[model samples]
Target: MIRILLVLILLLTPYHPNSITGSKDKLENQISTILSRIPSNTKTGILIYNPLTQDTIYSHNIFSPMIPASVTKVFTTATALSLMGKDYRFSTILFTDDSNIKDGTINGNLFLKGFGNATFSSEDLLHFIFKLKNLGIKEITGNIVGDDSYFDNIYYREDWIPDESANVKLPPISALVLDRNKTVSKRKRGRRTIYITENFKNPPLNIAQKFKQLIEENDISVNGVAKSGITPDNVLEIAESSVAITDLIAMINKHSDNFIAECLFKSIGAFYSGKQSNSFYSQQAIQEFIKKNNIYSINTEIVDGSGISRFDQVTVASVNGVLETMYFDLKNFESFYNSLSYAGVDGTLRNRLTDLPNGFSFRGKTGTLNSVIALTGYLMSDDKDELIITIMFEFSKGSWNFYRDIQDEIIKSLAELKKESSDF
Candidate 1:
């Protein structure tokens, strides 16, 4: 009878061969193996957290601040989405002090005013001019002036390297930007082709010149030259072009556009302070956001909106905190989540992590500088488990590919983690 009772007890006892602790241990081991491949001299910070269960799957030097590079966009975009709302739009307006239209002629200057629309291009300006023609405004006695006073006169941050000024990606930051402050000239030589790219020294003036060319092409006459100035209030609004903040954030985060990121950064400050936007006000606003969301980190510093400034630093913990806050924010979560570049999908991540198992994917933001590489985003599994992952490396030696490989290996191991089983 005792033997029979022992057999029954053994049969009734639950056998969980794949417990949560065991699964975590396996994950930790895999991650450690991957991390071991990293060069010892590299500064690294990593964190993986399960928001649903409030469990920290893994963490290493998560509080140490490192150069975030473009990963800073994650914070700038999230805060903009939260404060400005997803539907907010930045607009460029054509204002006229003289509204008199007698026989398709305007007597005064046409002021093209910009409110930090980063996507504004020559095409948009052409459309604005066409709208003027449609409105029977064929002649302007005054100049086609560009008004960019919405933001401060500083085109680029003081901390940025002076040599980066000519880079097309580091175009001049101005409220009035046309064609992203870039000029492309194409020429054909005997069976060969050459392209010349130049940055616009005066973006607003360039906008005015382009506007003048478009106006002349459309049979409109301008009596004066293109110039830059401030727009006076209470002017008659004639035409406008605008882009939604949602779209701006999408571009900024997915493509890591430094110019747009800077523009939107200033816009955030202008939105809150009701004053001309600048880096200082924008930094203050971002700090306010960190404080408000209780994600403050002593190591975190915001010198510019885009991580191009090497002075910008952030702790992995702070980045994870921002991700967590955005995850629970019901109103802005969808926009923020959808804006991230998907692994093996579109955006900068199009060619990355393509080997992820079926039904598993990652949506992340990538940051890279000469000596820094960072990736942070959500990793979703086939079992519906979501993990927030942040990995950053700052090294004096080694190529970006080496660090990227380590990051990819670590992610692959974490992707194998399953909520209900240790087998993964």
Candidate 2:
């Protein structure tokens, strides 16, 4: 995987935008200036639409298939909303056929069943513990077993970027997972080559001491680190887990968390097709969903729902189509759309689209790699018109300045259209 990712990086050399060619008044000219200032090596795919006519007004490599980075979340979140209703909430359940409850001790295996809830958390796990305690269960004499029958246990996709910081908070897809499968870490004052970490999951009071005891018995020293796990596949007691789906999405859309995004992608697959959803298979599900919805077919490619894969691609039309669909279901639509990173406020867009009118008016998911930058989502024009737009840069050549320039130009054009339409 490292070799393949490295090869991809080598092939993705930066290219600045050299020029923009089109016939839409000065829009193209302005865009061209921005593009030219960017190195010609930037790989950019642009598509603009006149929604009144439902016609494309400007396009360049609109469907050649390139990476979209976090823009892939649009599909993951959208497909999830479609397959699972917006109001859906994932639940974790405890079941035991025989419980020999006696003096704070139960003599049966504590079973955990995973139900494809991507938002499960440590605090939530604590809630489950409370539920169990409410049933007069204080201690268990038998081991724990996780039942992740709802999802196939195929964890990890081919598209994740490996250099990312790992966390136990990010757990593997299992029939039984704690805290959305995340582990905990403790920050150490020293920067030793080996960091302090722990996989002790569950209510801290119940298992922390036990976990330390076991580690001590094994002679593996811990540095008392404070960090979470990426994903765990072990059978452990359920403790305190507070992170939930709502928090997960906030991190995903606001911080462009690639790990959570990857997890959500797999969860989407697990939800519909069991664990049979791989990058190829899950993308098929999303693509088919798009086709069924009559969205543009030729403009999107998804290898991972998180857009981290270099193979993922998307278009302004497809994104616009999604936003248009949301117009019909405000409840779910708002949930999904609101999850997107606010420009300059959260996620990947934190530093961008900051100075627009009305405290700025773009709601988008931004994507960036070595040389690629993409922005796709809805823009609220100064005239109160909501327009869906995308400005993507692909390459061997790409530049942040170029992407920023084209994005501004696109917004400018939309604002102009809003004024023109309002004059009538």
Q: Please state every model's RMSD to the true fold in angstroms.
A: 7.3, 11.6
Best by TM-score: 1
What are the models' TM-scores?
A: 0.90, 0.71
Please list the residue runs of candidate 1 whose C-alpha ends up more than 4 Å from where it truly belongs after superposition: 1-18, 159-169, 186-193, 419-424
The clash numbers for all candidates, in the given order, read 0, 68
> Residue 105: error of model 1 in Å?
1.5
Error of 2 at 18 (Å): 30
Top-scoring candidate (lDDT) = 1
lDDT of 1 by residue, 1-424 (tens): 4324544654586756557568878888988888787778989999988765557888899988799999999989988998989889999999888856656888888899999898888888888877888888778898889988888778876534333432235778888888888999899999888999998888778888888888988999899888988888758898888999889988988888888999988888788788998777888888888899988478998777888877788999999988988877778888998899988888988889998766789999999988899999999876555789999999988899988888888887776556336333
Range of the 10 consecutive residues with the lowest summed lDDT in candidate 1: 159-168
